[model samples]
Target: MFQNQHTFHIPVMGTGHSIDTPIRVAHLGIHSVISVVDDLLCEKIRKHYCSEFDLAYKNIPRSAVDGRAERIKAYLETVHEIVTRKFQEIKELPLFEGNEKDRYFNLLPGSNPLKSAYQFIEHLSDREMRERLIEDLNNKMRPGSIDVNIMAKVDALGTDKDDQPLSSEYSDASAALRGYANSSLSSSLVLSAGFNPRLYSYISDFKDFYRDTSGEIKKKVILKVSDFRSALIQGKFLAKKGIEVAEFRIESGLNCGGHAFASDGSLLPVLLEEFREKRDQLRETFLPMVQSFYEAQGWEYPEVSDEQQSPRITVQGGIGTNGEMERLLTEYGMDATGWGSPFLLVPEATCVDDFTSQLLANAAEKDLYLSGVSPLGVPFNNIRGSGSAIHTEELIKKGKPGSKCPKGFLVSNTEFTENPICTASAEYQILKINSIDESADTEEEKERQKNKVMEKTCLCTNLGTGSLIRLGIMKPTYGRQAICPGPNIAWFNREYSLDEMVNHIYGRGESLVPEERPHMFAKELVMYVDYISELSLLTDPGDAEWKKLVRMQKNLEKGMDLCMEIAESEAYEGENLESLRLTVEKQRMRLADIFQNNLVL
Candidate 1:
């Protein structure tokens, strides 16, 4: 039950990149999340870690009863053991320069008690006193939480060998939750993507989620939210079930790395402002309901102060610099921050393959785009020339557009088949394309419709191929490797060591990114303006979509005004305010022209 000593946690990247991140960074007291979307991939990586650590490995076949859950459970337990073993070794090392033992403390924030103690005793002359302090520091030192992420809405219902659908309990998210619940690791479970009432209710079945007699929660719940409303609603739902959310990790809607959940034009700074004002509402509103549930269940609730308790508000997505981290922590009152996409450039931290890593390091801002490649139909943050994209385009040129559908984890389409099939699958694409061709539509429109159908790539397999390649579990040409990096990856142009990346986050030595790089807040404004402009082009005025666009326009204006105030306020040393002021004014004029044109409509 160790806590994260660092100020930032590494958010879960695509299905593959950060899958084994905890093993790479957790022992250094750095928090990182693993995605359990693909149990087959998890099973393979479990074997790799076991072989590397010289631990026992028993294969969990996909056909076994509750095998998906069982594989995830086994993998998580293995990670827990390895991280614990690694942390103990780090603690045993003497505090010497350039050693991991020193790195562990040096990685922590300047204000941390453990780090302060280590800094105090590292140069002490008295051998006995120094030895006593070192032992005390070891006792107090904690490894970061080995947290796991479950894309809540990606809970595809499973089918047996005969193609009979299984019960709700055997669904993807439920089984993943069961795996984490059964694992020995005591950490938070980040339920992201969106809400699944079934998944949230399924959480009540695990006693580890509830507080014990000692008032300590073994397994914590972290609802990955986009805004305050989602956080409030989801938090209430869990609270009524006697489950208090440990954190509401707000991610940017369109500015994030994975499936972009573009809200009705609401921006990140605006969302952070909402959480800042109503963070207490999260505690006050949920507490009474949580206490009532505990009372009804005949369980004793902890008498914790409202000032200090569960439901810490944290924000992530597109954070690039230490000044930005400081603003999030100090200005917005965020408990901690999550740094995700940048870590993909750090080989000592992520599981990116060599070929893919080169592409990411050399990628430019124009190369990173919001693409229509997700089988889920959400706008995915994609790179321009990924192996998967190239492979898909080649298939189209050969007059065969669609994937072979290897894993079938994201099979949610029912456009043609009675049983749901993935849009990325050959069967669905073939049926869809044939129907479009036969329709009485114009040739240009038909081509557009057909192109949309072929945009779906089999992410279930492609996303995990990078990890398999890096671990030597699969060859480079096994599958077309797909990578999803945020636009921030454009600023970071090379692979960084673990110590170097941590130093960048803390603003210790020279900055890793170029000095001309825009502040995280300013960069978000540019992204939002660009995103809203795209929305205006796609929607006609006075329609349902256009009404949403109108709301977005107002929100953007308010958000921009807030950004202006931030630029005008007391500046943090490296905040880069000039870029923000210039960007805001430029985007403001662009917004005016868009509004004027819409008025003509």
Candidate 2:
């Protein structure tokens, strides 16, 4: 069983999105995740909280103590203080007293008073004892002993020159990893486009650092993967490097917020089922491979108990209802379910401004779409009415197509010059727009190409600044805020308090979510169908396109079959089941029709 009272986790929102989100929610005794992409912000948060917690920065190095290390230390200290204080308060409560137990026993007159009193005292004492031991251990351990987790993106790890050591000034995967590894912070690295050998090498360095300093590897790494294949590949890659993946986090391809990386046509249910079936096989294969690497390296392989050998599998993306949440945990056997987008509505936990929060509340399905706004060239979940999008439009009208590129986190492209420039940079956009060969295509085609070049936004600053802007702590550089909310947000029509959101997650009370929203599975299916429709519009379809289409069609068919199976299951019954079945059937029929029409062509 999990240590936290809450069964679900809050997924990493944005560098600015949920900066202090974990701190706000950790007090509630729930394990939450915070993104460590912005070192400066991390430092600021640390300084602010450290002052609040009255914790001194004596243990950390003078230089690092003011930065990421300090931030992590402060966060951990704050969490510990909060949890310990809460525990102490609970232990002192009247319910734990002997007299209180006897009074409760007397209230139930038919029950044996002695037996009820004994049972109550024994249960209460056992619970208190366990909690006390846990608290003691946590206090004794390092800063990362708290339940809050950190998230690092493997791909977004700052783009520094190959020869230079990774800089913490920019948000890079290696820098974040190295920072946490060097500190007492534990976190998961999200791998989107498969394994990066460069990132693995950095992780190897991290292990070496821990080995040198702590005599044992101190860093516990979790791999956040979109699919099972990515998980296996990344797991094997880590095992080869003699590193253990603490968990395998499976996220829905299109249903997730942030940079939307669709897994061909793989559905979440199918992916989860595949992972459930092959988890043991994966662990069996991984253990020996990892053990061999450690032996060959002349390094000690960390001893993992049988219970800890296999990585825990968790799922995220578009999970709305309490029923859906329970099914994922109980039926699918998921270790945890991630409730992300809905938390955006909870201002106490997440950093959503009144304007953006209202925008999210009023958002419809069409308002939240997968847009080509990310400079990283990934499909980003975008709000159509966002200030950032409007700013980009205004800039285009002024004949300026891109941002100032204040933060060069996404500056990877060097197509136009010797020095690499961000795709979303005004310089890159101007160059790209100017270079478009008008003579080779129609005016309409030229216009389309120009518009495509202008679509990239400076998300590095925009995404990170939403909360700060909303809080009125920072002024908005652009006229609007850019938010990456999943389709699930459309179901929640109003902002909710932290307790209300948590209560809703625990099935204790009704949340603000509307009843008409489709099941998570159905929503993802619809998203895939939308993606397929967009895919079909590609003017020059190549072998890759055909392969992608084939994969999508097959996955669609498989997903529909899974839906039918779920519909017939005891766990899923009622009007929602029929709706899902019909939706899947309709999508399947549409796929058949597309192929049928293609054959005629």
How does each model score on TM-score?
0.98, 0.82
* CA error at residue 130 for candidate 2, angstroms: 14
lDDT per residue for candidate 1 within 143-224, as digits (tens), equals 8898999999998898888989999999999999999999988999999999999999999999999888877889999998
Pairs of colliding residues, candidate 1:
none
Off-target runs (Cα >4 Å) in candidate 2 are 1-5, 44-171, 186-193, 207-218, 297-304, 437-439, 476-479, 539-542, 572-575, 598-601
For model 1, what is the C-alpha lDDT against the true structure?
Answer: 0.88
Candidate 2, 1-601: lDDT as tens digits: 1233346777778666776665565433455666665555555555555566576544343245234444454444454465445444433444435542233222221233433443454466477775665444333221112323333333442323463434543335555555555554343444444466676667776553223322333445566787788888778887877777767878888898988878878888889899988888778878888778768988676554665667788889998877788778877889878889999998877887777888899998889899998887889998888888888898989987798887566777889886567899999988888788535788889889889989999887777667767655666563557889998898888888766776677665564565566778888888898788777657234457766787788988887899888867764321255557777888888877765665465
TM-score computed on alpha carbons, candidate 1: 0.98
Worst 10 residues of 1 by lDDT: 302-311
Candidate 2 — worst ten consecutive residues by lDDT sum? 140-149
Candidate 2 local lDDT, residue 107: 25
